[model samples]
Target: MARELMKGNEAVAEAAVRAGVAAYFGYPITPQTELLEYMSRRMPELGRAFVQAESELAAVNMVYGAACTGQRVMSSSSSPGVSLMMEGVSYIAGTELPMVLVDVMRGGPGLGNIAPAQGDYNQIVHGGGHGDYHSIVLAPANVQEAVDFMALAFDLAEKYRSVTVVLMDGMLGQMMEPCELPAMLPMKTEFPDWAVTGAKGRERRFLTSINLNPTQQEITNLRMLNRWAQVEANEIRYREYFMEDAKYAVVAYGSAGRISLSAVRTARAEGIKVGLLRPITLSPFPREAIYQASRKLDGMLVVEMSSGQMLDDVLAATRFTVPTEFCARIGGVVPYPDEVLDSIRNLVKGPLTTEGHPRDRWLKRMAERN
Candidate 1:
């Protein structure tokens, strides 16, 4: 199909259909309600299953059931709604089911605002429910990337038999951009050997998350950890810009990354050697990349919509070797390019104390913001 203007949420829905998603079960929530609305109309026309589930909890459970049948199933919601589905998501992960979940994140501590925020980073990437588990988290910087990642999400889920999450902010879901839509992928009707289809001319098989045997549970835990290690080794992805001979680097992901790119360019224009590192996957984070980049850079800046959740990972990546600073706009507000530019300027040119730390200088700049 020719490139056409599409809302980010609509593009995600279209891409899922093109990626051969067989079933969709979702409850409407702000900034992402259009995603479910799009699927509701399109899935039926494509002869696929679509359910406007009674609630977020029920929606995720429906996805879990469909995933067990070896079908490409999906569910989506915003922050608060996603919270309700965490228990179901944890169960799906425990069962080693392949499923795609989209989180068009909004600000939240409780029923917050229907505005963009990356506050869900810790909850989604680090496992919100009770278990030692990790979801393959994809953070797209634009609508096109979000569309492209939909196919990748399903591919990675099926390949590893793991849950994959596409993380987007509320703005990315509501904004419109020109997108080159992916072609339709052929649907699969045959079930996998591990799928829990009824026994027919074969021995009985069981699929359960309850491993009552302590030793067996340990073995399962080790297997999952090993699988995650492989994912970390092979699935980590990131994009870098203007790193050669840079004095400082800025790290951001998703919508924040897109905004920071503009700030990077602005900083460069003002004679600051600022570079950007955009992480595509949050789980298998680009640690090695950051480590290598930190060796040459004088300092690092972490920009986010949240109160520096991803910054912890950035600090760990650099081994706290370089002076790092953070800037954020919380409570559903997005940082302007000028605001990020100011942060970069402070990191690059602001006065450092006797200890040569940027904290005093960065704090002074932050205080000026008020």
Candidate 2:
């Protein structure tokens, strides 16, 4: 395929269309609004279904309906908008529907500003919905990753019979970059008898989580757990750099990670032996990769836009591997390269953790950490 320069949002829409997404339903939100616009223009041209929903909730429910028909459906929104879709996200998980959600995240809490914030890290990785459910979340760093990740999201969603999320930030959603996309695959829209479209030829498929009976709900929960365990065993992804010869490492993903990687190169030129452990799949969270890298490196730096939602994952993953310095900047602001460089500079000398200074873990509790 010919290489071309395109914005991240456009790349994702093209990727979805080419990779066999049957339908897309979404509401416009900042940062990711361009993505919907792109899909609106192109999906119809390709004969794919696209709906500009009345609201985020309606769009997500539309996803649920189409997913019930076994369509390769997707939806996109910013952080606050994603929060609005959490209920539907949980329902999708409980019903074990194969679908994709793209969260081109902006700032959080409640209508926080839109710039480029990784504040949605915890929400995306930890199942922002209410329940013991997990989505196969993919965090793409640049425009290319945005395109590449959408396909991965679809594959994983179908493979595990679960929801998958593509979590990007504003910079990733807005930036333009070169991409050599893979050849297009044949699209499929085969709805199985298990789907809840109608009783039709195969009895009736009950695609729902509303089990009012205690025994039924327990059974449903157990089924979801079994599926989750299987997913953990089979689905996990990450990207590693400079591990062959490195003393320190930084952990980040989405835009925060891409920039941290550039900073890693800068640190390398300055004789600082730094590396990066970027999480591509955030739910099955590449725990083994994290442990392996932490075992080899002297120290790790957890750099993120939020107060450090990803930092806790580092500590949990590296409990016996290595110590990590928690680095973060929250709200609508992002961490600059200098800040990441500074963290790497510190990691070059010593280990950093909660005990060293007492406040760098729970992001919401800022006063406690600083």
Candidate 3:
């Protein structure tokens, strides 16, 4: 495929069309407004359904309704907008409808700002919606990955009959980069009998998130858990950069991983042994990869745009067996390559000691700043 320079959001919208997404219902929110805008124009041109919903809640519910007909459906939003869509997301999950959501995240606690940040880590990965459910979360570091993962997101959602989220920060969404768009995927041929598409001369079908019967709901929850376990076993994805012979490592994802890769390259050139472990799948995190990588490293640094979200996963992956350090930027601030390089230098400067938890070190740093 020919490479084209494109903004991440635009690439995602186009990718969805080529991936055969039948409908897109979304409300505009920055850093991802371009996604909805692109879909609005292109989906209409492609003869696909498109709706500029009045609110995120309405948008997600529309996704729910479209998905019930077994159509490839999607929605996009930033942090606060995603929060508004949580109730609908819960319903979608409970009902076991397959759909894709793109989160071009911005700084947040509450309408924080229109800047890149990984503030929605917990909300999206750890069941933002209620009940025991998981979303297949893919965090793409660049425009190409964003385009590629947008297609993968739909495939996985259908394969698992669950929500799949492409979690990109605002930086990736707004930045223009060269991307090689993938070939168009064929529309899904196997439609479930449960899909509600006109029951003329056939039995009626119904899909509902509500399960008033306690025992039946428990059974449903158990089934969801089993499916999640299957996803974890088969769907973990990540990239290891210069891990061989490295004594120090930095673990990051999304745009932060992109920046950390540069820091690792710089550190390596300076005779400081550094590598990067970038997780592509955020929900079924590459825990085994982190563990194996930590085995050879003297220390690890987790860089993030938020205070420390994926940092927890890195720590979990390391089992606190390796010394881990954290460097973060929040409220629209992004840590530069120099800042990551400094953190790498600081982490490897001292003697390696596997002492108390990494959180203590993070807290000590916070205390010093305060």
**Steric collisions counted per model:** 0, 1, 0
The residue-by-residue lDDT of candidate 2 on 1-370, one tens digit each, is 7899988888888888888888999999999998899889888988889999999999999999999888789999999999999989999888888889988888777988888898887887887899878788888888888898888889889877888989888888888899977778888857666766767566655767788998988888888788888888877778888867987888888888888998999999998888888988888888778887888777888888887677777777877457667677778778788878976886666545436421334243346546
The sequence of per-residue lDDT tens digits that candidate 1 reaches over residues 151-205 is: 9999999988889999999999999999999999999878788887788889876
Off by over 4 Å in 1: 352-368
Worst 10 residues of 2 by lDDT: 356-365
The worst-scoring run of ten residues by lDDT in candidate 3 lies at 350-359
Q: Which of the two, 1 or 2, has more lDDT? A: 1
Local accuracy by lDDT, each model: 0.90, 0.83, 0.91
Error of 1 at 156 (Å): 0.5
RMSD of each: 1.8, 2.8, 1.5
List TM-score per model, in order: 0.96, 0.92, 0.97
Ranking by TM-score: 3, 1, 2
Worst 10 residues of 1 by lDDT: 352-361
Candidate 3 C-alpha lDDT tens digits along 131-190? 889999999999999999988898899889999999998999999999998887787777
